[model samples]
Target: MKVHFIAIGGSVMHQLAIALKRKGYIVTGSDDEIFEPARSNLAAEGLLPVADGWFPEKIHKELNSIILGMHAKADNPELLKAKELGLPIYSFPEYIYQESKDKTRVVVGGSHGKTTTTSMIMNVLKSAGKDFDYLVGARLEGFPQSVNITSAPLIVCEGDEYPASTLEKRPKFHFLFPHIAIITGIAWDHINVFPTFDIYLEQFRIFIDKIEPGGVLIYNHTDLVLKQLVEQHPSSVRKIPYGIPQHRIENGITVVTLEGHSGALKVFGEHNLLNLQAAWLACKELGVGPAAFLKGIMAFGGAAKRLELLARNERLNIYRDFAHAPSKVKATMEAVRRQFPDRKLIAVLELHTYSSLNEQFLSEYHGAMDLADKAVVFYSRHALELKRLPPLSPEKVAAGFGKKDLLVLNEKEDLLKWLMEQSYENVNLLLMSSGNYDGLDVAGFANKVS
Candidate 1:
């Protein structure tokens, strides 16, 4: 099959292009601008566009398919030309569904924990000698590509609620009709697309309904909101409720003892434990038994940035996480504090996303950082301007977080200065954000923890 890509510079899009190329398909692509890693990766595969601009001539009737990336707009010249030629065009998720429709689909979804949980399931399945295709949001250990397509009978996906593309306004998860689905937990996020909490929640409801009939819906029973939602939604899919696995923290390690299969896990946190239970249930449905699953999962370190330890010492350790939403921030911080109750937590959060910077949605962060002994919130004015959002004041941010003593700084230099003055004796530094605190020097401060 010969395929062409429209706006192929996206993180996952470029990766998908590479996968198709390695699959022996004739692949070609173009983008308005290609960034560093994507550019390098695409060039390595000889799939990078000859130019950075769209070339309408690339669209032809001979092409079997045109995979569209979210970066491409509806009126893109290449897209229009493809329509003119009556060629097949598909959004990333739509194309993924087309490829895996015959396979047994297992999708993990939630506002948080989805990536880690999906990674766990993939690791267990792989170690169990099962052949499967996968699409995860983050780079995982032992997995070279986040997107892999093959003739594997089973496919595991980290379902995302974001819009599939400009052409397909529905959530990306809606396209993957899973035979077995898992929703870790639902929390309001992506305020720009979903204006209210209820609206944001409706997406997951649609996702649950999209599961194939006679499929299984595994949900987090501990999340009261999700529990009620799953119970209220009547469907033919079998309902399986799961909670945190039986686990304990010993010497900063989380040990799980389930059905006599006992071992210490490389990843920690109540959230991760809950994720582990979800992964266990999904793997069971996929034919992996408890003993086998435990043996495989015990070696799972974590996804790229989900509570990754950046720097460590005897008395202090610094952890970086891709957690920006209120629920994620709270859970991540609470996990660190619980793991090292004797140590002081110097937590820093960056208000980087459009939702986090918006005054209307800022109140959702109330008490999110309260678990920390020293809490700090940072945001960039340039980011706000780029998003065309209203200017947010420091007082407003403090009130929104419900912590008057919260050290809110917009300037990266100020944040760096304050962090440098902190006492790191017996402390755990937890830095949380989808962005890197406007490029603050986290390593510089982490190096001083010793």
Candidate 2:
């Protein structure tokens, strides 16, 4: 097969390019801006473009298909040329569906915990020696890439609610008609795209409708909105609801009780426990028993940047997470507090995403950081200008969060200074964001602090 990628420098797009290259498919790609890791990895794989920038002449009739990335605009030159040639163009999700249409697709979807839950299922299946292809959002411990394509009978996908491509405004999950679908939970997000909560929720409804007939839906019953949605929607698929499995924290270790079997887990937090149960149910449908599931999951450390331990000492520990949404921030903060109840937790959040920096959306974070002894919000003025948004004052941020004591910093140096002045003794520091703090080496900073 011959596949050409347009704007393929994205985190997942580059991985998909590599996956296809490894699958022996003639893979070629071009991007105007290629950053680190993607630039290096693609070069190493000999898949990097000869030059940066789109060449409309590169789009030829001989090409089998064009995989478009979200990074490409609608009027992209290469895309225009592909359309002019009458060649088939596919968004990543559409192409994934095309490849796995014959297989039993298990798609894990939700506002939060999708990556972790998808990784858990991948870990269990891989540990059980199951031949399967997967596409997870984050890089896992054992997975060579974020995406794997093969002639396997099963394909597990981390279904995202974000738009699939520049042309496709619908959620990516809507395209994958999963035989087994899981919704970990739902919270309003992507305000830049879905302007209203009702509209955001309607996407999930459409997703449920997209499930194949006689399929199975495993949902988080603990999430009230999800529960109501499932109850209200009459479907042909079988419904199974799961919550946090019986678990207890002992000496900083988390033990989950499954059936009569009990095992310690490397991942903690109520959200993760619920994620585990969701993954367990999906694995059960795929012929993995409770015993095997427990054994496989016992070794699961966690997906990258989802509570990843960066640096730690006897008296201090630092963790980083990809938590930009209000609900996710609250959940992550609560998780750290629960894990180390005795430690004074300091939660630092970076308002980097479009929604997080928006004036209206700022209030959604009210009381989200209440679990932390100290809460701080950081946003760069340059970031606002880049996003084409207006400047936000520190008073506005503090007022939005409804915390008069909230420390809001806009300068990276000032934030660093404040962090350096803090006492790290017996404190748990949680840094949450979908971005780096303006090129701050958080791990190195954590090491210095520790």
Candidate 3:
């Protein structure tokens, strides 16, 4: 099969291209501006475009398919050319569904923890020498690629709720039609796409409806909304709800207890506990026993950037998390506070994504960081400029968050200064952002503070 990619510089898109190439498919791709890792990875695989822009000549009738990345516009030149030639074009999710049509698909979906849960299941499966294809959102420690699709009979996917592509305009998870599915929780997100909380939630409802008949849906029963959704599913579909397992936190470490067996865990927090439970149930449906699941996950550190420990100084610790959503922010803050009750906590977050910077959606973060002794919000004006949104005042951010002393900074220098001046003595600092604080070096800064 010959497959070409438009806007192939995307994180997931480039990985998909490489996966197909490894599958013995003829792969070609183009992007206007390719970044470091994507550019290097594509070049390494000999799949990088000849030039930096679209080439209409590349779109020919002989090509078997064109996979469209979400980064591409609906009227992209390559896309238009492919359409003119009546060539088959598919969004990323659509292509995934096409590949896994014959496999027993397991999709993990939620506003947060989707990547972690998916990676947990993958880690356990790989440890047990299980052969399966997977598409996780983050780079796992042992996984060579974020996506892998081959002749495997089972495929695991981290199902995101974002629109598949500019052309599809459908939530990515809706197309998976998983035989087994998991929802960690539901929190309002993607305000730019869904616009309203109810509209954002309705997508999950559609996802539930898309599950194949006689499939199983595993969810975090702790989440009231997800519990309600599981109850509403058809009788033919089984619902398995899980909550926090028996566990204890000792000296900032969490231990999981299963079937009277206890072991130390690399990952902590109630949210992660629920994530582990959902993963356990999914693994159970796949014929993995409870003991195997517990033993494997004890070594699972985490997916990239989710509560990642960057540096440690005596009694002080600093963490970096890809946590921009309101629900994620709250859970992360609460976790740190609960783990280290005596230590002072400082939470610094960046308003990076479209959903986060949306003025209408700002209120969703109300009291999100209240658990922290100190809360700081940083958003570079350049980011807002690039997003074409109105400049947000610090006052507006403070009001929206409903935290009176919520320090807000628009300049990177000022934010860095504030971080440096903080008393690191017995304080655990959490730096949360979808972006890297406008390219600030996390390790370098953490070292200086330490």
Best by lDDT: 2
lDDT of 3 at 120: 95
Best-first order by lDDT: 2, 1, 3
lDDT of 3 by residue, 235-319 (tens): 4688888999999988889998877778889998888888888888899899998778877898899999999999997879999
For model 1, state the Cα shift of residue 192 in Å: 0.9
TM-score of 3: 0.98
State every prediction's TM-score relative to the real structure.
0.98, 0.99, 0.98
Candidate order by decreasing TM-score:
2, 1, 3
Per-residue accuracy of model 2 over 1-450 as CA lDDT, tens digit each = 999999889999999999988889999989999998899999999999999999998899999999999999999999999999999999999999998999999999999999999999999999899999999988788888899998899999999999999999889999999999999999999899999999999998999999999999999999999999999998878999999899889999999999889999999999999999999999999999999999999999999999999999999989999999998998898888999999999999999999999999988989998888988999998889989999898998898888757899988888888999999889999999898888777877988887
Error at 95, model 3, angstroms:
0.5
lDDT of 1 by residue, 254-310 (tens): 899878789898888899999999999999998899999998999899999899988
TM-score for candidate 2: 0.99
Runs in model 3 with CA error above 4 Å? none
RMSD of each: 1.1, 0.9, 1.2
Which is the better candidate, 1 or 2, if ranked by lDDT?
2
Superposed Cα deviation of residue 241, candidate 3 (Å): 1.0
Cα lDDT of candidate 2 equals 0.93
